[model samples]
Target: MNSTTDDTYAIAIVGGVYRERCMRPAWQEVYGSAGRAASAMASMGVSVELYTYYDSITEPVLISRAAIEGFKFSGESIPKSIIFDYDHGLATPRIYSFGSRQSSLRVQAEQVLRFGMLEGSATVHGKRVVYDPQSPAKPEPFRQNGSTADELALILNYREARLLSGGVSTSADLIAKSLVLDGHAQVVVIKCGPLGALVHDGKSTDLVPAYRSRSVWKIGSGDNFAAHFALRWMEEGKSAAESADLASRATAYYCQSKGFAIPEIFESFTPEAIVPSEAFRNGRRPVVYLAGPFFTLAQLWIVEQARKDLTDMGLEVFSPYHDVGCGSAEDVVMLDLAGIERADIIFAIGDGMDSGTIYEIGYARAKVKPVIVYCENESQENKKMMQGSSCLMCDDYVSAIYHAVWTACSL
Candidate 1:
């Protein structure tokens, strides 16, 4: 444990390190939460110390080590090691852990960071700690020995706050109050995804909007938000609102780049740079809306494949089947219409007689939106409609998506 002087600015990340397998865009292995945050902070000229378990005997641990080594921060400081072996599999927002150990380590620094339950029951006391309850499914309870009232707790969404309060309250004030009442934290931050985040400092709560990004690969966005907020609040002496705003910008940058390095423009970013209208607005890029029948397994799988292919082509996508699940009938209609309205182009799979998808195509055409229809087996009536509406019809899915991208860019 290192004692901090009044002017010392150092950060210590105490969590479990693992390898992430991204299914979107492509299947590739990358660094998990802890490693990503450490590298992100280090790239911003902050000295970071990582406390995690790593053993060469375990293949996952070895992979995690290799991933960390590939980052620029691997040579910044000597990482402390713990002797627990575990395999962490990250499937987007969800983490699958096997052989995870639950042991505590004494982390000494001005600020301490913890993400999920996989970090174990490490007791952090008498320090400015920042904790993120990673998932609502498996929430991490706060446990500590000594008393310190200056801590920040970050939640993925408002629903996850129930795990901390043991009650059913979604209000940011109530959640923050519940955490403070339970002696869990003094400050609480709830990340509302595209809607931005809410920060409560036990006195007042503020809502911070997320910045607009050109592309969004939402795997490690929360980790980047926590890392930036901790550094700005603890080291830079920024207010909670200011810290949350900066963190949102940093997260937007991460989501757009989907890389480890932070952009130099974010060093002096301002609130004026944010879109201010919507959190997930498109930035100088074409937005493609995917409309198809997602009722069956095969249909849903095809839609997902098309989404990934379009995403890889550097275009923003609005997949109603993936984004809007089997909700209420009214809710589904409203959500899908909003997505369609924001899109510059619509991609429809017209192979089968899907009434909902056909209606979507009609609505998009009515709005003067370009339509790209793909149907291997189409009827005469369907072909007549496709030709009448000036849609590019193709029998192949790949060719249809490529044509959609080209058509969208040309528009």
Candidate 2:
């Protein structure tokens, strides 16, 4: 809008800057909401600014990235969240929040800002509000932290939309329209993970299909999507629907390359073939048969956690531990086999190389069902035949689960 580029930034991200410690598959570093979004936008040569809260005492490696890819950062003094990211895909990263969200900032009209009502005390002078409800399950969370409805673009996942809109309908169009018509938002963007995204601007809704990446990296994906969308729609003045579609492609690239390589242009960039994976197509979710042992406490925990994880990801699961308990040998065998037959995919625990679990995997394979084995520390000799039979054996637990679901959804 103006030639005063030094005084005006194209995008402004207000979120967090904190430590992220991931376990099972271990990785420890400082990664935050605004920190990531700013980095991503800056990587693409966007003039961006980040506003966040972090421990000013220790002064963690906040943004010492490549010189050209660095953005302007304003950090509030706070011992912020130390998020524990575990291997259990179903579980949310446990945030050990130390400080209160008491901060303020000036929202310039020239800047495209996305604030989740983090600091309700701040004076927002922008034309539109960018709302991210943070988490749906926070203790009485969505209390309108600090957002206006007029000309608001609401970015939310399925759960947040459900919490705000009410009811249990999974249709993105219905949920988005309800928000728009009800005046919760002028524009509603429902991020449906693998099923793409729904962009609704009161008049109509469009489903921007998600491009399947070779390796699906879950961490910071939402932040990447939101930043790219802000750049395209808010900064560059693209339509909501077109911006959303472009954002989806950008997100796929982020996942595929883990934000290492930045494309020159968003519109012309095709990291890989844009193959859409419909996890839920025509109101049908592929059934997943969870085959694993429950003899020991450790074994039982894995099986239980995996079951919940798969279910939370919106797949109907037939877990032997939950679906069928202690029973006669003949009955258990028959029931488990029946479950396997009905399932579109089989996720088996191959760590212990349990006879029954192995049998289930073999049976599922014989019956032409897709099988994913989570064998973290099993020998190659032991899994040779299963591998030979074309079973997808994954050493990482999370990868195994995702592989199974993706395989099943594609099928």
Q: What TM-score, over all chains together, does every model reach? A: 0.63, 0.86
TM-score quality measure for candidate 2? 0.86
Residue pair clashes in candidate 1: none
Candidate lDDT scores, in order, read 0.66, 0.70
Clashes in each model (backbone N, CA, C under 3 Å)?
Answer: 0, 0
**What tens-digit string does per-residue lDDT give for candidate 2 at 209-240?**
77766656667778777777777777777889
- Maximum-lDDT candidate: 2
Give stretches of model 2 more than 4 Å off.
1-8, 57-60, 66-68, 79-89, 115-123, 138-151, 166-170, 264-279
